[model samples]
Target: MLAQTALAGATSFRPLRFSDDGTFQISIFKDLHFGKSKDLVSYNNDRNSITVLNTILNAESPDLVVLNGDLITGENGFLENATVYIDQIIGPLVDRGLTWASMYGNHDHQYNLSAEALLEREQSYANARTQRMVSGHDAGVSNYYLPVYGSDGSSDPKLLLWFFDSRGGNYFRELDKSGNIVPQPNWYNKTIPLLAFVHIPTNASLAAQTVVGIDANSKPGINNNVPLAQQGQGWCEDGTNSNDCAYGGQDIPFIKALVKTPGVLGVFSGHDHGNTWCYKWDSELQLPGVGGGNGLNLCFGQHSGYGGYGSWIRGSRQLLLSEEALGRGELDTWIRLESGDVVGSVSLNGTYGEDLYPATPNDMTHS
Candidate 1:
């Protein structure tokens, strides 16, 4: 009886729910870039971000909310203020009794707070999916999977949700005895609308640009080697030139997992604030000799926070998964601006002609 009581008393994770129509809705906001700097402009920007977040939350009324990355700016060097930013961003979700999740970005650790510390703060929220389960790798925290079960409360999951920490650039540590400071090895590299949230893009992200069909916006200011057109409106900074980006260099295995996972409709990230393009990446693209195979949809969430640097209009990405679409191995997603305009959209599985994939909103790619 004592042992049974102990087991029964343990807390359990609440499985994600779907709407009455057997469809699930998710609103993903990235690069919130929220900061609490003491200045008129900074204060106003933070307020605007909060208002936009609330507006999107009320407008879409999604089943789940994902605050992708760069959720907060840390240039102020104030660690205590971190919680303040999280509270402001998560307030809408709490009020509506909605479940949400988050990931850290490259700038998130600017104020000396590590990603692990940030995750600890987010775990305090009752509805957050940030359980502190160790990922057993050097990738740090923000590595876990959430299963979206059927609305009937079945044990079998209908869809899988993945979150990865692309980590901020490496900070310099003290030198070793041999007059050299060997940096720690990069560990985490990995994501999907089958969806992921990461702060930095991987080398695979850079390679995907060459193959995607989307007419991505151009940014001439970027200085990366991939050329201005391939930059996709923002710089595609991967781990190739930067040693602090990810572990095991390019993290090809991580990217391959996203391709191998079944029922994965897309993978979303938020690092390049100005880039918001979605395209397909097959195994052949990752490994030239592999040939063509089912690929994963790679997408970048629109910049939603005012704290970051970017001249583009800010918005969030919304994904709709209907039971019929899921049965047909398809999902629908689009970018919804704070002004309530649908920028671009696509059908995940490529099977068009249904009410899900309207011609007006953009379609990512058919696999």
Candidate 2:
């Protein structure tokens, strides 16, 4: 039933991307489950995630910022309550200067520490020159391949990021047992290409299907056991069991292993909470954000959809890429909202069609 495309059925709102010779402008904020803010929906903490990150860094001052994931809904599910809300809300946006990167959802590793106490809780919540620019496999890791340069992005052919993990099988039962839902073949063979990141969303990253057979080998066993499902319950896609891992998992082998491979460009995720957004596997380009509202969004205000805390506001968008888009098309994510001052753009490529949100004060109803 996944039909309704234009940013995949636009509701919560988010689709920002600019880089077609436009120099820079990166602002991606997903699943700000900032320590479950007080559940039962509209969840937000870390002071409402730093007051919605200082009102979107002073209303879009961004050069770059990607907090894309349930940055801690770890609650009683544990991992030190999602590393104390990532050491107080995503480590101070990389200590103030911004230009950041982080990915992991399904309540950021829910809890359960082994694998050396989850690698010593990922080295006491990494962030020291972003853990020495992703140490290349260890030396106090932060997962690697950052490069945000235009002077500041450190190094390594700049702008090629990949911070994947996507583990969290519902804390072994509502969050803990040393957390980990999936995606760990040594972090999937140390992913490559120009991009990568996951917090969950690899049921072949949804093109939606599986009425029966071939939907990435349908399975709801997510490598075994369970969390919270029910869309046909055997991981949908026609389940009769046989080792179900949730129909089309591992996002179709992690997008067939990095879109086109060489210098990969994009791939990001953040559980499916609500106030959603998409563009799962971009062969090159088409990098989008925000998808946290499946819990049950009672309108923008979220009664509980995706557990709440969903906000979206934009002013511009339109990427139109293609330096031969890695694997030939599928990466034109879109989103823009400003409402009254007049601004609108929300085309999530279900074959494009949004002039930009609902209009008049950027209204898209819902709430």
Instruction: Name the top lDDT candidate.
Output: 1
Summarize candidate 1's per-residue lDDT along 159-257 as a digit string, tens digits.
777777665533323346895533333324343446565556654566665453334332111112232121112222342333253233345556556
Name the runs in model 2 displaced over 4 angstroms: 1-21, 28-33, 36-46, 50-52, 59-65, 77-103, 109-165, 168-186, 198-261, 264-367
Q: How many clashing pairs does model 1 include?
A: 12
Tens digit of lDDT per residue, candidate 2, span 146-176? 5544333333333455665544333332322
C-alpha TM-score for every candidate: 0.77, 0.27
> Model 2 has how many clashing residue pairs?
52
Model 2 is weakest, by summed lDDT over 10 consecutive residues, at 294-303
Best by TM-score: 1
